[model samples]
Target: MSNLTWQIGCVRVTRIEETLTTIPLTSFFAAATPEALAPHLPWLRPHFVDAQDHAILSIHGLVVESQGRTILVDTCIGENWPESNPLERSALLGDPTSPFLGNLERAGFQRERIDVVLCTHLHFDHVGCNTMRVDDTVVPTFPNARYLFARTEWEHWRAQEDPGFAATLRETVEPILAAGLADLVECDHVVTDEVRLEPTPGHTPGHVSVRIASQGKEALVTGDMAHHPVQWAEPTWGIAADSDGAQATRTRQRILAQHTDDDLLIIGTHYAPPTAGRLVRRDGRVRFASG
Candidate 1:
């Protein structure tokens, strides 16, 4: 766990890390190449990029404490990987060891105390912790939390014939739905006065970024709209998993333009350490200024 936290007026958000590793730029980004990334390497190194120039990716969940409610953002890859999906397991969790739950409890966020489990999308990494293996059956990890899923996201993945996604749906989401603890919500559903969902599609249909507003302060929890800070410089670069690369680029461009030179904190879902920053114009390009 990075033990990183941010305050947005009346809301406090903490990062509960599950895994942190580097991925080859070519493997993670479609347009990322050594020559193409050379210009931004100065600011990207030491945090976003490693000595080998690989992208540093963090798999973690944000614990949002707002209005006396504890709302968990995206759940990272869980402890147990479905045996039926060896490809997904090997791709997502090559090591299979996870410290997510322990980190949450250490941070004072008990499983039973969680008021909501809000997933931005139904991807394997984002929704893997929705359930846990108990004996021979899978069950909801947060027994008392109401798992919230975007109706469109749920329907989209529910109809997916892809084996990896189907396995994820079976092991993580279906158990919660069967237990009657799931709630299908719109993309822009409000979780609280200080916290709400902002529809930022294209990474996946029905994908949403979380918006927090309180005491005149604001922040946006980007759910893969832009994976790395380099995207602020080149919005056209997208990950391989993107359903619509052009739409994802457009969303990034619109949001970056809207928040450029503004005070709104940009909390990236897959960013490395010092993950939150503000967008600003520098050298005729949008840059992420991490504090």
Candidate 2:
């Protein structure tokens, strides 16, 4: 468990970590190269990047407690992918013994207590824990929660024929729908008065970042809109998993421009320690200043 908590006005957000590891820059960013990343290494090192310059990625779920609602945003990779799974074999290597549930409990969020399970988009890592195996059958992990999926996002992935994504969807999302626990909603569906979906398409056609506003304070839970802090300065750099790289870049530019120097707390969904920060202009470029 990362055990990181942030208070946005009256709402409480907790980070329940699933995996923290270093990924080669090239493996994550399509345009990343030693020369292209060298300039930003000075500010990115010791946190966002390791000594070897690999990108430090944290796979975690953000639990938002707002308006008497315990809404979980983006369930991290659960304990389901087997070694023989195609995605596990090629990209992840093997199934991880993730302590996600135990950590969630320690963070004081019980599975049945969660009122809503919100997925930004239907990706393997983001939605894996939507279901878990019990007695050789996969079932909804949060039996009492209403699984929220952006209608556009659900439609896109539901029609996808890609083996890796299809496999993940079958394991994680389909079961929830089968159980009648899913609510296919619009991109900007409001989860609560303090928390709502902010449509940030491009990573996927319907990818939505979480927006939290309470008592005049505000924060944004970035859902792969900008994965690494480096994107603060290099918004054009697209992740390899992006469904549309050009659109993703445009979305980053628009969101970054809106939040730059605006005092809005930007909580990265994949950032390492000190994941929450504010954007500022430094050396004529936007930089994420962790507080």
Candidate 3:
């Protein structure tokens, strides 16, 4: 398990770890196909840990506590999610006695205390805890908070017409909407003066990164921009979930360049513990200086 740290501001941000599993460079680069990945394979081997385990990706979430509000940005895969994808589902189930709930308690938050819940996108991993099953019906996980979502995101997924998509809409978003507890806002919506949304699409039709600013300092909660630090070094290597690879690449480059020379901190949704760090440009390379 990695360590956790709190970065204080108008948003008292907390980094919470759920689980970490390493993936071989092969599995990740496989998306590149044999022809494209062959030359890079040798170069990547040294940086990656070998095993039946190469995907050392950690499933985690960011809890933004601002104005007495405990807002969870994304919920890592929840326990017992009914997905058939073994690797993801296995990551979910691997922690049979996960300290997620306990960790929240220790950090001084309870489900009922959360004032708003926001998800960067509707990926299964990002919104896993949006709802939980009851005796027969699904219900909002944050009983008293209004869940926020990007308007375009909800619309795009709703139009997909997939059965599982419908299930997620019904089980997670619709119920919250029905209870008048869902805030569907545009890409530029501001949850508060301190917390606002930045339209960082491409990963998904409506993916957005959260921006927090206070005391002349700021941080961007980059939800899945680059799954890990390595991606900062190779922005063109898009993730499998990205809806538009070329556009995603453009957005990644823009974000990295904009923050690389400045003092802005980036809190990657999947970054190793504490997850909060700064981006730096060295020589001709960029990397996350995890702080």
lDDT of 3 by residue, 202-261 (tens): 888899999888777888888876776666667888767688878887888988878887
> Candidates sorted by lDDT, descending order?
1, 2, 3
lDDT of each candidate versus the true structure: 0.89, 0.87, 0.72
Rank ordering of all candidates by TM-score, starting from the highest: 1, 2, 3
For candidate 1, the per-residue lDDT at 263 reads 97
Q: What is the lDDT of residue 176 in candidate 1?
A: 92
| TM values, all candidates | 0.97, 0.95, 0.86
lDDT tens per residue, model 2, 1-291:
349999999999999987777789877887888888888888888889999889998889999999899999999887777333645523542345677788898888989999999998988778978999999999999999999999999899889877777788888999999999999999899889888998999989999999999998999999988889999889999976788988999988998878899979999999998899998988787788897
Candidate 3 structure, TM-score to reference: 0.86
- Can you give the lDDT of residue 15 in candidate 2? 93
Candidate 2 regions exceeding 4 Å error are 82-95
**Colliding pairs, model 3:** 21-55, 21-56, 22-54, 22-55, 22-56, 23-54, 23-55, 23-56, 24-54, 24-55
TM-score of 2: 0.95
- In model 3, how large is the Cα lDDT of residue 184? 89
